[model samples]
Target: MKRIFFTLIVSVSLLFLTSSAESIDNLYLIGVVKKISHNKVTVNVKSNVCRGKKDFNISPHIKIKLEEGDFIRFQINSSTCKEKNLKILKIMKIHKPRMEK
Candidate 1:
């Protein structure tokens, strides 16, 4: 039936759209909490290339309490090379305690 064929086509199209999205990950050396607005954030992130695709929202895996100096690894799902297109999936902060040499 035509109805059955149409339903199959719609399902296949949805699957392809979801699977084609890109993925990316990057390390962010956290600085001051610049601001928090909506689902977005602005922080001074330090990395080899200071500017890259990054997500503003902190991931759920990140502990509720964090400090300014913590270094965090951020994972995002997005289209490559677009700033606003990235979505954060996971966040792991690095704890570095100074060692006396």
Candidate 2:
């Protein structure tokens, strides 16, 4: 009986750990660029959990040029929501389809 209880506890703990890791990997957002500076960009976030204009720090290694009013999708670290450290892990611009007359 003791052995069975120990096994169950271990299984539950492993499950929690995996789920938390998956949640962190899924932290990303889609937004529109409001402004761009040397090491940061202001984005008008469109996600359900994070909506509004917020500034996100860009890594110095990422050299992508972005313009104002451009739509973008970016992945962020888990600390983004918690401590407001809004660092970008990956970033890409999204093009909108042109409307036909």
Candidate 3:
């Protein structure tokens, strides 16, 4: 009985550790706004791992005006290493630094 209980506990602990390791991490991407509609925005993502156009649903609570061809940085809730299954959590516009004469 003692051996059986110990084995069960060890198995459960290993299972928990593996699941946590498999969990996704938040992803940050820099992109150019391609289009903005009612509740979704399309962006041309420029990144080493994930590139090309991707559409993300906008959070209803977030109210920010975006235009086509605007450079922006956005955060996704979580993504796979390949950046699949993306959901936008935050968005910010990237402004170029003014050149000093």
* C-alpha TM-scores of all predictions: 0.41, 0.65, 0.64
Residue pairs with colliding backbones in model 3 are none
User: How close is each model in CA RMSD to the real structure?
Assistant: 6.2, 5.0, 4.4
Best by lDDT: 2
Model 3, CA-based lDDT: 0.78
Q: Please rank every candidate by lDDT, starting with the best.
A: 2, 3, 1
Q: In candidate 1, what are the lDDT values of residues 20-99, reduced to their tens digit?
A: 65433543343334455556656555554445324467665644454444445555554332456444556655554455
How much is the lDDT of residue 23 in candidate 2? 71
Two-way lDDT contest, 2 vs 3, winner: 2
The whole-model lDDT of each prediction reads 0.53, 0.80, 0.78
On TM-score, the leading prediction is: 2
Off by over 4 Å in 1: 1-40, 48-55, 60-64, 79-81, 96-101
Residue 90 in candidate 3, Cα distance off native in Å: 0.4
The per-residue C-alpha lDDT of model 2 at residue 93 equals 59
